[model samples]
Target: MMKVKEFMITDVVTVTKETSIKRLLEILVTNKIGGVPVVDAENKLQGMITDGDVIRYLQPKGRTVYDMFTLILVSEKEDLQHKLEYAIDHHVDKIMRKKEIFTVNPNDDLEAATSIFSKYRFKKIPVVDDSNKVSGVISRGDVIRYISTKLISDK
Candidate 1:
């Protein structure tokens, strides 16, 4: 069976909670990557940051045009738009999602990889070593490409 490490990208670009949005955006645009693992100075996985995070930081707060869907507007002392704008000029810790981040070991099978991808619906999965340091990343696109080229295409 194919292993996660087999198709995982070894050279991963990572950022820290302290990484600014400008820098993060530069990385995403320059590398054309959807997401990057958020790590500490020691390279330990802190969280995951993505283009979604960036967009989350850009969303405006107000009533929107919902053709058929319901729009719930809650009264707030501070709105999301204000926070996002403040975050835009501030740090990543403010906007980056720090929830239950899923990780995979490099030696795990592709089945495990697929399961994680399916369950979490994440574009990229961080590959960690024995030390829990991000060794690489395995993206859904990579897995699909791998399966198509090596599994489906092979007799």
Candidate 2:
């Protein structure tokens, strides 16, 4: 019965709500991670942001085609660029997922964390303290590695 603290990554990368989308993207790319937890100045968990969220936000809205016989298809390429620029300049809070965030406590059983990940299909889950402060993060990769080395080893 391992605890989350035994396997969670203590050197966690985090971001604030005021972080710009451009910076967020840079962080994600630089860290080679899919998502990060958003914390406040006091280090309290505020929300979560992921590459998927950014992609969803940047996806173009549905266009309506009134006529089927239109010969000249005018595409607003500049409009799309402008929209992306605007979105990137905006803060992360604008697009971060805030509600129904799944988290685990450092003292919780590892099985509990595994259940959450399996049920929600989450790539990572933040480990918080009793005061709701992020102490670490645990990813699916971490769990898999632990299982491979500890449970299924041919000793």
Best by TM-score: 2
Ten-residue region with minimum lDDT total, candidate 1: 72-81
lDDT of 1 by residue, 49-142 (tens): 8999788667655544455677656434346646555665566776776787888898999888899889989999899988889999999999
Clashes of each: 0, 0
Cα displacement (angstroms), candidate 2, residue 54, comes to: 0.5
Decoy 1 TM-score against native: 0.81
lDDT of 1: 0.83
Please, what are the lDDT tens digits per residue for candidate 2 over residues 25-143?
Answer: 99999999999999999899999999999988887654544576775442556546767888988999999999979999999999989999999999899999999999999999999
Best by lDDT: 2
Model 2 is weakest, by summed lDDT over 10 consecutive residues, at 71-80
